[model samples]
Target: MNKQQILRNRPVGVPDEKTWELIETEIPEVGDGEMLIRNKFISMDPAMRGWINDARSYIPPVKLDDVMRAGAVGEVMESKNDKFKKGDFVFGMGGVQQYKLTDGKGFYKVDPSMAPLETYTGTIGMPGMTAYFGLLDVGELKEGDVVLVSGAAGAVGSVVGQIAKIKNCTVIGIAGGPQKCNYIKKELGFDHAIDYKNENVRRKIHEYCPDGIDVYFDNVGGDILDHALTALKKKARVVICGAISQYNSTDGMKGPSNYMSLLVNGAKMEGFVIFHFADRYSEALQALGRWVAEGKIKTEETVIEGIENFRDTFLKLFSGDKRGKLVLKV
Candidate 1:
């Protein structure tokens, strides 16, 4: 039997047990062009919250009674496709389930020798690609540029700061607690780390980047985005990655009141989805792999055991109970 978490209801705020139903069903059989994957690690992301919404956006929202859409790394246990063979390790949108059925579309092979499978779900996977392309391509990052990244201790934000440092740019990370702040500054080599929980974010950004912020990689939208907007340098680029703060709000998202600062500072803010750069994934994966091997980039994962704990483990993304990438070991 395959155990899966099905979306029971569209959440108004942070999702709870009532929003999901865990049930077991017969393991799906591989068809003519399909493969069966036994999921090993399931990625829990803030984006999952947006996916459950009834509203339309970049992609169609996940429908009712569907397996919760997610990314997972797993081993192919059965295969009918020529590209995939039994025992091959792969990654794809496998959902929050113990097993997945695929036709080889949107799935890629993963090598354990290159990096751990869980790392693919974190630093070398979707979150890593978001940080890489969003910072370098969208933000147009350059040497000596003062980069400010919100949610700096989380999955994508941590990588954004590290990559900036590699390019010889000054990096500032805004995290919730002192521990996370210190992890970014001391461990990840961010030039400055702001504890938004305790410090005045706008004031701290001013102190860290007095000359002004050249790139703002925003993951937490709301007050932090507003603060970063107010501190933009001339021609600064803001990358809209994710908005965890407003994802679950009963009211609609709050627009930045100080957005006029963009005009005054002659800066630009752009939003991007990683899937848009699907054709160029190899370029990012190769570069990120080299960086990790050279110890220029650091990767972290908070692994929770059991498929049964999906709902509770998912809440960690919002509560900041876990650091780095949150992954479920099934």
Candidate 2:
């Protein structure tokens, strides 16, 4: 039998127990030209919040009573597809279920020997690709430029800071707690770490980047986005990655009050979905892999055991319950 978590309702705020219903069912059978996967890990992301909303977005919202959408890494249990064989490891949008049936369209094989199976869900996976393209392509980061990153202790932000350093840029990270701030500065090599929980964000950003910010990579939006706007240098680029701060708000997303700064500074702000650069993934992966192998970049994962804890584990993204990449081990 396969246990699955299904979306019961569209959440007005942070999702609670009432938002999801768990049930057990017989494992799905593999059909012609299809494969069956036994999921081992589920990737919990802030983007999942947007996926459940009925509002129009890049992708369609998950329908009611359907398995929750998620990225997962798993092993193929049965294969009727010629491309995938039994015992092969694969990654795709396998949802929050114990077993997944697919036709091998978006799915891809993964080599666990290169790194741990879970790292593919973090630094070596979507988050890593997002940091690469978002920073270099969208942010238009340059050497010696001053770069500011929010959610710096997270999977993507941590990689962003390290990549900026590798390119000879000054990197400043904004995070919630002293421990996270310290980890970014001392361990991750970020030039500066601002603890937003303890300090005035606007004042601290000014102190760190007196010359103004050349690039701002935003993860948590709301006030931080406003502050970054006020600090933009001429022709600065702002990469809108994810706005986790406003994800669960009953009120619609709050527009940055300081957006006028963009016009005043002749700056640009762009939002991107990683899939837009799907064809160029190998380009980023090669560089990311080499950096990881050389110890120039570090990856972290916060793993929670048990699929039954999916709802609580997902809430950790908003509550700051854990750091780095949040993943569920089944």
Candidate 3:
């Protein structure tokens, strides 16, 4: 039997227990050119909330009663495909399930020896790709640029800060709590860390980037985005990755009221979907792998066991309880 978590209802603000339903279903036999994956890890991300909404977005919404949309890493228990063989570890959009039966589309073989399977969901995976392309390409980063990243201790934001440092930029990271701030600054090698929970965010940003921000990588958009906008230099760029802060807003998204700073400073803000850089994934992965090997970038992930406890595990994304990438071990 395969236990699959399916979207039971469209959530309004925060997803409740009724929003997802887990059921045991008969595992299908592998057919010709097909493979059966015994999922080992499931990725928990803030974007999962937008996926269940009954609205138009970058990708189609997860249909009602369908398996919840997610990125997972697993081992191929059985395979009939020429490209993949049995026992091969792979990463794909395997969703939130104990097992996945796929025809091998949208799947890629991953080297578990290179990094832990959960790192596939964090550092070298979609979140990593998003940070790689979002900062260098969309943000048009230059060496020595004063770069600021929100959610700096998160899966995506952490990578952004590290990459900025590698490119020889002054990196300032904004995170909640003293622990997370210290993690980014001391462990991740960020030039500065702003504890939004305790510090005056705007004042700290001013003190850190007195020369003005050249590039702002926004992961937790809201007041922090406004703060960054206010600190933008002439010809600055803002990369909009994910807005975790406004993901579950009951009222509405809080867009930057300080957007006028862009015009005054002759700066620009652009949003990107990671899929847009699909063709260059291999390139990004190679660079990320090299950085990991050289100890230039570190992978931070929190793993929780059991697919049955997915609800509580996923809640950690919004509750500010988990660090780095939150992965569920199946």
Candidate 2 matches the true fold with a TM-score of 0.99
lDDT (CA) per prediction: 0.94, 0.94, 0.94
- Model 2, position 235: C-alpha lDDT score: 99
Please provide TM-scores, in order, for all candidate models, with all chains considered together: 0.99, 0.99, 0.99
Better of 2 and 3 by lDDT: 2
- Candidate 1, residue 272: CA error in Å? 0.7
Q: How close is candidate 3 to the true structure, as a TM-score?
A: 0.99
Off by over 4 Å in 3: none
- Those runs of model 2 whose alpha carbons end farther than 4 Å from true positions after fitting are none
Residue-pair clashes per candidate: 0, 0, 0
Q: What CA root-mean-square deviation does each model show from the true structure?
A: 0.7, 0.8, 0.8
Give the worst 10-residue stretch by lDDT in candidate 1: 9-18
**Shift in Å, residue 160, candidate 2:** 0.8
Tens-place lDDT digits, model 3, residues 101-200:
9999999999989999999999999889889999999999999999999988989999999999999999999998999999999999999999989999
TM-score of 1: 0.99
Instruction: List the lowest-lDDT window of 10 residues for candidate 2.
Output: 315-324
